[model samples]
Target: MNISWEEIELYLRHTFVTARESKKNVKRVIVKLEDDGFYGLGEAAPSPRYSESVETVKNFLNEFNKLISENMSLYTTLQMLNNLNGNYSAKSAVDIALYDLHTKKLNLPLWQYFGLTSDKIINTSFTIGIDTTENIERKLDEAHEFKVLKIKLGCEDDIKIIQTIRRYTDKPLRIDVNEGWKNLNKAIELIKYLEDNNIELIEQPLPSEMLYENNRLREQTTIPIFADENCKTFEDLILVKDYFDGINIKLSKCGGIFNAYLMIQVARYLNLKIMLGCMIESSIGISAAAQLASMVDYIDLDGNLLINNDPYTGVICKEGELKLINEPGIGVMKIEK
Candidate 1:
């Protein structure tokens, strides 16, 4: 197998702000794997929140190249990833590429390989990043076609922000506090206000470490709470099953599709709902995540949609519904620059 990679910057259409930080653009590493004349593609959108960056991903890939050979199987590669420390995003890039290469060799779509169907896939939520009230209105207008909208909160003026958003439209809304809220009482109070509004769900209201606070807050609110930062891998799910109602599984954060696939089974056994998510990535990563959309309860795979320049095209989302293509593997094609 031949492995190669290059760093690319993706400009966001809007300033993507979360409680932790803000970003106008993001750096990503596009990884390629070639074996027996078949090529597979993947992307690594490393997040600083996870102590990962472009430099870290690149360094991990360099070490990764020395660990495997042409005779290694996909299972072997996945098992090897467990031995490596951290760098889930970097491991995810190689993990996705291997799955793509393996699936293509068998001439089967990724979902088909897992004995899943696209019919159960739900519409994704278009994110409205944290911005000024005026900018929020503009974002809302632009997302008119989308059936659901995810509002990013965690600022000092969260109530004012949601109020500003409610004035614009009454579309179904999901709130992502990004672990912004601190006090359990305060989170409970905010939940009351969100409940009166069109909020369908709340994500990470308190900090990731506040497991007891989250469980207490969950008991007070009727709305379901989905864990994002708190739930990174299958192991994290076990720890957070009693804390959150559902888990937001992002491939980059969880280490790849295979890991995410295993997570779905474990989450179900733990009686937790599943929400498939992604970073601010191109279609290569988003499409790879979408292949497992059929197994998730909610979809937040709109990372590619938020970007202005996506180098690859796959898994078209029309009015929020992700249309998974029938092509072999993860069904993505690079666009010529």
Candidate 2:
């Protein structure tokens, strides 16, 4: 097998601002694995909050290449990769590549290989990043095919943002605060207000450290609260199960598909809802996440949809629904530049 990676710039269609940072262009690392005249692709979109960068991912991949030799079994390769701590995004790139390679070798679509039925897949929400009301309206117009919208909030004008979007469309809304809110009382009040406005869910309202506050908020409100920053690994699930109604599993945060699969099972065992999400990535990454869509109650794999320049062709998003092809592996092809 041969391994290599390169950095690519992902240009967002609009300025995307969270409480943490604002981004117009994000840097991602694309990893490629090749063996026996077949190629598998993966992506690593690192987050600063997670302390992962292109440099770190590249270094980890370099070390990973040194540890593996020819004819290694996929299970052993995955186990060896799992043993290396941190760099979840890096691990995700490798994990996805391996899955793509393995599934292609078996000539089965990833979802089918995982025993998931196509009808079980749900609609994905298009994101409306933090922006002016005028820009928000434009973004909404651009997202006409999306029946669900995920809004970025946590600013002083958060309520106004919801009100502005309400005037345009009645689509079910999901709000992500990115750990922006600090006050529990205010968070509860805001959540109630959002619920009244047809908001389906609220994500990461408070910082990860405020587990007690999150639990109190969850108890006080009827709306489902999802843990984003609060839940990174499987162990964090125990701390959040009492507080959050569900967990948003990002491959970058949990190390990749292998761990993400485990996280979904554990969440199901605990009777918690599951949402598969992604960072600002290309089609390669989004396609990888989409493979696990049928296992979750909700899908937020619209990262690639929000971007203008996606260098790969993978999942098909139409009429707010996510559709996967019957092609083998992750079922994505590179778009010629």
Candidate 3:
């Protein structure tokens, strides 16, 4: 088998403004591997907050390519990479690519391997980024086609934004504070307001590492709280089990599909809701998560699919919904080569 890696930049259609940040571009790695005439492809993204970079992942890919020659399987490939880099975005790229490679090699879809339901349409939430109430209202109007909306919050007036959106549409709403909330008092205040407006869930209003703070905050709210940055690995599970109502399993953050599934199993055992999420890549990466979305309780995959210049194809997301192709190897066609 031969392996190749390339980094590409993806531009968002509109400015993607989060609570603490705004991004105009997404940097991704495209992994290409060939065995005889058959081929497999995978994708991943790097964010400095997660300690990832193009040069870093490429260097890791070189090491991963050499390890594959030693006949390490996908499950152990993650273990091997973890032995090298201690679980970062580079590890996840190889982890997912190998899963795509494994399923394609056996000529079976990834969902079957994971025992995921074959749901053709996975409802997604269109994100309403942090901005002026008027900007959010305008975005909601433009995003009228979506049934579920996720509002990003970081300000003292976030509850007003939710209330403003409620006036536009009574659609199901999920708010992600991205650890922008300062303390339990303010978080509880915002939670009460959101619940009054019929918001479904709130994500990581407090910092990920604030186990005590988050647990205390969880006690004060009726709405579910889903942990993103906190639940990166299974070892962190016990610490957060009582703190969060759900977990957002991003394949990139947890290292790969193997660990992603492991986290889901643990979350299921704890009777916690599962949210399959992504770190903003093209359809190739989104489809990777789509293969897992059907098995989870919630999905937040509209990230990369909403971008204007996603350069690959394997899935279709229309108006805040996902439909993955039933083709072999994640159904992605490499655009550059």
Candidate 4:
């Protein structure tokens, strides 16, 4: 068995700003696993908020290589991953590669291997990052195929941002505050105003640590609230299940497909709506996230779509719809330079 990784730069089509930071270029690590003349690919888009960076992911993978033995079963591999604390992005890269390798060996696309109907996949929302009204309109012009839009809020001009977007298209809107709002009363009032518009859902209106405030806001607002920063692993779900109507599951946040599958099952058991999401990454990472799209109520796998240079291709996003091609093992192919 052989394991290696490379750092790559991903430039967003537009400036991506949240309450935390502004991002123009994102650095990611691409992991490749090779054995018996076959190779599996994975990617890790580390988030600083989680204390993960390209350097951390690379170091973690180096340590992970020492744990690999000959012909290791997937179950044992996952157990090994669980033993390691933190570095969810690193674990996700390895987990995705193992699954990709397993599915390829079986000659089945990931969706088919999971017994998921491709048609069950829903439309993915294109995101409009925080920016000026003119920039927002220009971004919308570029997003012709996307019928649904996810807008970033939590600024002083939150209302103006929604109003600006509404002036152009009546498309369904979703808002992610990224733990931006601090006041519960003000959050509820803004949520009500957004509900009166065409907003479909609101995500993480308050700080993640404000569990009581989030629960209160959930009880007061008429719109559905999805938890992003508040919910990471299944344990976090236990704490937030009563507060949030749904959860946004990112492979990086949950560790990988193995845990993400379990998260979906637990979310279902709790009767919570599921949303599959991703960070700014190339097709390799977005495609891995898309493999689970059939199991979720909504998807935001357009991270690859917002990039100019995607080094891999797998899932195709056409006019807001996600389509998986007939290929084995996550159905991803590396583009030859």
Clashes of each: 0, 0, 0, 0
Candidate 4 least-lDDT 10 residues:
113-122
How are the candidates ranked when ordered by lDDT, highest leading?
Answer: 2, 1, 4, 3
Q: lDDT for each of the candidates? A: 0.90, 0.90, 0.77, 0.88
User: lDDT per residue, candidate 2, 18-71, as tens digits?
Assistant: 877898999999999998888889899898898889999999999999998879
Task: Choose 2 or 4, whichever is better by lDDT.
Answer: 2
TM-score of each: 0.97, 0.98, 0.92, 0.98
Candidate 3 backbone clash number:
0
| Cα lDDT of model 1 by residue, 38-106, tens digit | 989988989888999999999999999988799888888879977798999998998899989999999
- Against the true structure, what is every candidate's RMSD? 1.1, 1.0, 2.1, 1.1
Identify the runs in model 4 with alpha carbons over 4 angstroms from their true place. Answer: none
The local lDDT score (0 to 100) that residue 301 gets in candidate 3 is: 84
Candidate 2 residues lying further than 4 Å off, grouped into runs, are: none
Q: What's the lDDT of the predicted structure labeled candidate 1?
A: 0.90
lDDT of 3 at 331: 65
